[model samples]
Target: MTYFFPKVRQAQQHGWKGQGNKAGGWQEMSRVGAGARLFEATAVGIALLCLGARLEASELRKSPVVRAVERASPAVVNVSTEQEMQRRPGMFPGFRGDSLFEEFFRDFLSPFPRGQARTSLGSGVIVDPKGMVLTNEHVVQGASSIKVTLSDQREYQARLVGADPPSDLAVLLIETKEKLPVIPMGRSNDLMIGETVIAIGNPFGLSHTVTTGVISALNRSIRTESRVYKDFIQTDAAINPGNSGGPLLNIDGELIGINTAIYQKAQGVGFAIPIDRAKRIMRELIEHGEVHPAWIGVEVQSMDEALARSFGLQGRKGVLVTQVAQGGPAQRAGLRKGDLILSVGSSKITSRQEFLEALSAYTGGSQISLGVVRDGREMEVKLKAESLSTQEAVRMAERQLGFTVDAVNQASKKERRAYSMSGVVVRSVEPQSLSYRVGIREGDLIRQINDKEIRSLEDYQTAMARALRRESVTLLVQRGSYGYYLTLELGGGG
Candidate 1:
């Protein structure tokens, strides 16, 4: 090609002649000049043909999926955590890894502890330029140290901002002098059923792995042995153990959900916490360090076939309101006892669990609309949810457990001197109350409620507010020298 360029130029300059033929007619110029012009035209055409082919190949390689990954991959991060665990020996010394035997005898194991350090790997996404990272709570739960690696291989030590175990969402903060890249958030409420979605995560210790799939389903519920997770966005993407906190993006490279691989038994099914729901919890976690249970002051029971028939609602789905707290949100909104709640906002309520899950989306002071059926007529009621007050919490404890508790500081000197720890002390217990039946005495100190440590009145109020929605509440009651875990059945007393 280089040799041809010089020859072509030489031919154009020297291959022309103006001469007369022997017949005295005008003579033709040199054919080399014409050939040179033809060659130049062919070469230009071939050059353009090659250029067009290269441009087409480039366009083909950059599809929407590729572009999305390119735009969002920088914000994806690898999360590694180290945790200290206490390993106890099994009853059968030789059956260490036997699944059947371990499952059968797990509860009978003794508390003989051995110290062990465990390391886990997961993925996260940077949501804020100030180094706010969002990941699953289980990723950093009980971790002694956390390390976050960005897409650029820059590693930083991370501190836990807050975690909500019930929601299974957590926030982490990393310190850096410069701003970090963040993924743009997208809404999940308007997501189509089969739209294209991409998941970016570290799967099996593989960093920044990309997988593409469609939204398989929405508002899906997953039930485990311990509890049920509701309102999950289901996708067929290949989410594995290490993909727990990664981003699920739409075609536009906007984050629509956080990928979670909770259902390990499925072949291709994976679930994600919807971005809309995650946003609500994220705000609470960042602002308050924890998510407070939103209370609407209504007690509901699942509507069965018999109950539906009794209420003249044969085929409609809803829950029956058994009680509405006086001066609470429901009562103030004109909701009464025996009202059939058909929906909470846009979410249809078919059972008590569904109602609770739907209500959990809102926070305190949020004005929500409830669809109700009163006297066989459908109506909507708007109410503002409020946090349960300390006084109201005490009354609720008495009503539910048949016991009343006061802050530790309010206890008598003898009662206060009896324990060196800080907690609430029982002021009184009704004889036939669930607490009394469980051998809880007046002098016993309540050290904990469920998993929450009750150190003050505010802690007890918050714990009781969250626990009252469950069927049973566990109390760690400390008598003179011994601590007892007592599970009290709620809604037993007037």
Candidate 2:
């Protein structure tokens, strides 16, 4: 306590100097008594602090939380992104549909105006000494240019490695050539509730702002428009809009999570991606440019105690298989309707989220053992999960067709769109291409081609190959769940 109150003690000693030289001996002694009383009060306060009441000022400055910020600040960065969005043709000065309109407005509808330049700010963490940085996908999505400013004020132009919108994570690379400071990574799996945590980010353009709180919850579920990743670390770390993708550190100054989202309506409620999950994603993005999702082709329902009884089961111990995809890994491995999946590998399945999580651990071509219950019997089955990279499906659509397409199960570049069935989505149609003229515009799903219903990537490709053989083809398309017919006639060599 005296260490924290040295200035007060020094002032008291100085204040009594002149009074002692004067005739006011009694006044000087009274001042000494006052100083002694103050010292006693300070001692009591320090005693209370030691008893876990509060922290002394000097001790607070040297706390673990402050030390964590000092250790991690060098790895934090401020991200600024500038994107040039293409401007479309706006309405002309004159109106009409024919000769007069075209004649009067010859200079109108000329070349589109220059693309609008938009700038945004966010936070990022330097994860590697090789100049690899991690941030939120939304922070740099569609950015024509990105600039990263380090804690030391060194700036560099960043290149996008890859971005996954579903995960809301993006990686950027800068050619710094020299070694960069990095934060020590910590394990979120070992994190306990109410453990001390620190968040450092650029909130509202405020760079390297530090906030501290306790881990409020773990494995929190976040629901967006189209997807949900059930593992998040909830903290009250004052994460703001621009704080997205910053580091969430443990008391040891090691990163345990990434600040991602905050509820607008609720105060002190913020969410972060656990560092354990992010490590895998970062490795995948660096190696493959994207994280591939592992999927088992089946429709599953969570079994409740009542539902288990109705299906003649004992307790709520497994997920029920309502339907299995034909020619899929589940069906090929003898999985059938009405079979109950009791466990995957060594982990028991109790919810849809848990089952999906277990299945996600295995990649394509990997063999997995499933413990299933058939009619009046329990059984073990082994199968190979059979999805090539879902990104490959998207790349196929873009390469073979005159447009980019999206699938229901794909991790989009910028969003998680709602797609109920397995059909290829027309994301962007090439200008003046047959797809554009045929009313096959963006947002249309090629549901069927000449009665060959498109249900998968294989079906879409086969139908497209058949359509290429004809000069014209009729396609049944679904636009926003509304079905319609479109006839596309191609010119020779188109």
Candidate 3:
């Protein structure tokens, strides 16, 4: 519970009771008239009072999140992730590294911890009566073991059902002999800015922690470890690190979002994945093994005020198509660079996020209706979406990393140029990432593995062979601005 009051108020109007001595002053007959008006106002006020009371009673009854926490708490579980540490060679070997001293001293001295477990805890909302759960993708990223404990103190080893890092959401499945009570999902699109929202999660590993606040804002964008998730619901709902993956519910106990992140340094600033997006991902994860995105073969940029005028954009709406991929769906549909996409199907596409979101609703091979504006002319086109390959999906996911990567496709000249390296090239650094943490990215032209200057596939192979043997190794590299080294620690078993 965070609380804030508005800083401004509307001015109230005051009137004289009646005309007394003068026209605007109180007088006997005027007083009688004023009394009648007061009587009417009093009756109205009483009626309003009764109506307010009734509404309050109804709201109290409908606030199921508040009422049902005690019962649902048993289903809301706490999760902890763990991974084994890689073994690192010691400063002095054959001190027979088998002693506790070897374990403790080696772990403490080595750049990478040895046999140590990196752990994180978070909360989850049970969505299926069979013990299937929902949580944030970050909560379980890189985790080799996932342990879930129910409110009743019973524990289970959970398996990852599916996860969408783009949306920063994940789902887990635990087979339990007993039935579980799942929370109902509510329509987050219907939520208002000031409507009450309840967050139930295990913050700081505290089970079933409940917090309340109002919807602070909507359509927020937050950068996670893997991607930039857009259209998040903002709330001052006392969310913390462990709160990630818990359900953000409305007064009726219907889930509106999946609590995902909070500003560590800022108070009352938290974010959640809107239930609508979560629902879409959940469907794909349950149906396929992964979430599939709708792809239009075009690079898009948002139409800002300055760019809109420069491009002579009409009506100040739609996203600018910067580049249309050759032979892609967009190019085949006749979409060209400098064109502005106005809509997908019936939904309007005003920004890049909106354009992407609108397309996510459909799958490959579906005929997509698009409206575009080009050279002062309005045009429409229908495109048949092609099913994206796993490689393509990986490329799309990498885009959120703010890096330039090329898949290994030697057929096309452009692809050959881009795919010279077996792995994607590091074009830029996203603010949050292990690569960024180590300070090695952006225009680096990643050429080698540990101690091996790599110019070709054989070089990379030889380097990886040596690097994988050690717990941690340094990548010798060159950058556009300067040359440096990057030490990468291979985390425990995945």
| Candidate No. with top lDDT | 1
Judging by lDDT, tell me the better candidate of 1 and 2: 1
Give candidate 2's TM-score.
0.60
Clashes of each: 0, 0, 6
As a TM-score, model 1 comes out at 0.83
Give all TM-scores, in the order shown. 0.83, 0.60, 0.60
Candidate 3 accuracy as TM-score? 0.60
Local lDDT at 56 for model 2: 56
For residues 7-39, what per-residue lDDT tens digits would candidate 2 score against the true structure?
A: 445656677555545556456566767877888
lDDT per residue as tens, model 3, 260-298:
764465477888888876776776776775665555676
After superposition, the stretches of candidate 1 with alpha carbons farther than 4 Å from their true spots are 1-38, 85-116, 304-316, 387-394, 409-422, 431-433, 436-439, 469-471, 489-494
Off by over 4 Å in 3: 1-65, 68-74, 92-114, 224-226, 301-311, 314-318, 322-338, 342-387, 390-494
Error of 1 at 328 (Å): 3.2
Candidate 1 collision pairs: none
The lDDT of each candidate is 0.82, 0.74, 0.68
- lDDT for 455 in candidate 1 is 82
Looking at model 3, how many pairs of residues clash? 6
